[model samples]
Target: MELSGKGGGSRERAALGLTFVLRHGRRTGLASAARLLQLFDVKIHHIETRPARMPQNPAEDLEFFVKCEVLDCKVSSLISSLKKVAEDVEGNREGKAPWFPTKIRDLDRCHHLVTKYNPDLDCEHPGYTDPEYRKRRAFIADLAFNFRHGDPLPRVEYTPQEIATWREVYEKLSSLYPTHACKQYLDAFHELEKYCGYQADSIPQLHEVSAFLSERTGFTLRPAAGLLSARDFLAGFAFRVFQSTQYIRHSSSPMHSPEPDCCHELLGHVPMLADKEFALFSQDIGLASLGASDLDIEKLSAVSMHLILLGRYRTNERTNKAYGAGLLSSYGELMYALSNKPEYKPFDPDVMVIQPYQDQNFQQIYFVAEHFEEAKSQFQKYAMKIKKPFPLHYDPFTCTVEVLDSPQKIKKITSHVKEELKSFEKLS
Candidate 1:
């Protein structure tokens, strides 16, 4: 849960990158490339890749696409490898065991800790404490379960130790955390993990985890980290009321229904958070949201796009790598992001925050962070712009997308039209 010395030994571990294979033009090296990637523990699961042009734009760059039939075995193996990487990082962090605090009472204490110990970290609390705020939070929380868990289940209880562990992470993370912009993100994990306490069966390894979403809570069954929980909150922002369907689609399925399952949530997003540099980078961006205007929120959405696509865009070896959970879990996305074919732009948080995103398909454009520190410094310099105790604009749709009374037939039709087009495209 609170990995201490992840990426231990600082052997200069690299982020993951896209792996492009010209399925049509160059089959010659495809096998070797795939083999080499396998040697690197990278996976190549897509079986039906092809070069295709954009539907609307005739002149847009062509892209390689795939709809591989992934067996549970292969997926499980991929997950094992990824989990190994994540575990290695976490083990390393624990070895370091940086002096993390156990608890905090308020934002002032939170601030002092951040400035004193983690000046790089940012925190936010989306002023959701008013009655209306409580109602909204409850509504979102309820909807999140509805879509995922399917019933008003009994309250889940946390063990004294598990509760204490979460309290410890929350306290340490909250201290010096700067923006409430990312509160929703953090809360998503907190909320789900709270569900874990009910399902726990006296397992100690699982006990150390405080906030865990059960299989009932609209995700594939797996233990995920808080950051991934936050990313899942965003990906499923609009689908908070229905159960995360277990029926995975085959290559024959009409649309890319890569269910936003626990594998994607935990495997894709959480490891990067294990990286101190990336964790602080995210805190900085989240802090930017506190003072963000509606325009800033809009721009921040673009920033999310930039981060998602960067998981794939391959530039320099460093620039080519990604820590995003989305790319980590999917063979298709992992391949595309590591591939050099896609255009890679310089990482620019501000410009990215303003860039328009296509919610219907994979990103065609991406920005590359110059260095982890560049992202960190960017947040540090702009931390002031991030407002404290930020306010949120309400979207009736965002608030209630999953709760509308609609039959499965109509719901499927509407999802195909609006959500299915968008869901897998955006990686949290």
Candidate 2:
């Protein structure tokens, strides 16, 4: 049987099959390869084409399955022949190019997760499609883009309207803090008020807040472009780095935001980060995110946000504070969550990690912790399940990630640091 003309023939083939996936541009070459298979008495079972999921390049790829009862040696020969055809196709397109069959690797999964969530590095929320919102977003993005990891955080000059928005939220939440917020949050809030400019009529700069957190818990803030993927955002916490937005929420909706704004980040999240136990708990969640699959990262992100927003609290009990920023920052939601409306469940890592997240509106259920220590203990136990091969540490001085891939690497890095410290001590 001679196969020719795109090899578009219908034939009944046997059960034994081998499948090969090739880029769409290789379709003509695939047909030619099919002809070679026919010459070798290998029957072509079927051919399938599907669109590639590449957002930037929305092209299609081809898959071909061939049926044959050939020996192992013959199958190897068949693979080599197809590879040659692919190389020839490439050579014709680009001079002296080499082609090889694609192989799946462990890192492919990680790369896919990043690409899936962050197709465009400059992704903006749909609401920001308006020209005015775009301008605000661009301004924030410029600052974030220029920022380097270890340098001092850039100071942002808030417009009068922005300061007004901050003033409104600060005044309301501050009044409620003494009565409704947890003790730890109130303490941190008072400290911030005194030291970091956490008061009415003035917007506190991120550098001041970052410095405050650094002194207290080694947590520092990095400017964020906008709402980041769960994986990317949580990964920062592992390094004691918080990706924060410099932009305030749209002035029109000061109380509500479809996405995170400066008010939500500064007021809702930063206070908890200032608490040592809560900071550790947050980092533990981030540590588990290392080498986690996309689905697991999504679960982790949801759980982290849930804990932050609708923190664990009991009804009519004012002794234990709600540590979640979502509760501490939002006057309405905080009061609503503490009320007798939402179902309150004990903090269970197993259930909470996989629980579906609802961001469109207030959550119907919340997981409550007895205290930050309890939350931290539970989170540590949950983190043990993560099977990342290498441990990661953030270097404050250099502002880089150190992957302790081997014991030797750890010793080398630490010994160098120890010697440097000794030299400084001698000089002093």
Q: Output the number of the TM-score-best candidate.
A: 2
Worst 10 contiguous positions by lDDT, candidate 1: 105-114
Question: Model 2, range 324-377, lDDT digits (tens) per residue?
Answer: 877776778877777768887788878887677666567788888776667777
Candidate 1: tens digits of C-alpha lDDT, residues 120-182: 221222221234433332343333322212223223243454344334323433332122112
| Alpha carbon deviation, residue 312, candidate 2 (Å) | 2.7
TM-score of each: 0.35, 0.65
| Residue ranges of candidate 2 with Cα displaced over 4 Å | 1-130, 313-320, 390-428
What are the lDDT scores of the predictions, listed in order?
Answer: 0.35, 0.65
Error of 1 at 247 (Å): 9.6
**Model 2 backbone overlap count:** 2
- Reference-based lDDT, residue 61, model 1: 20
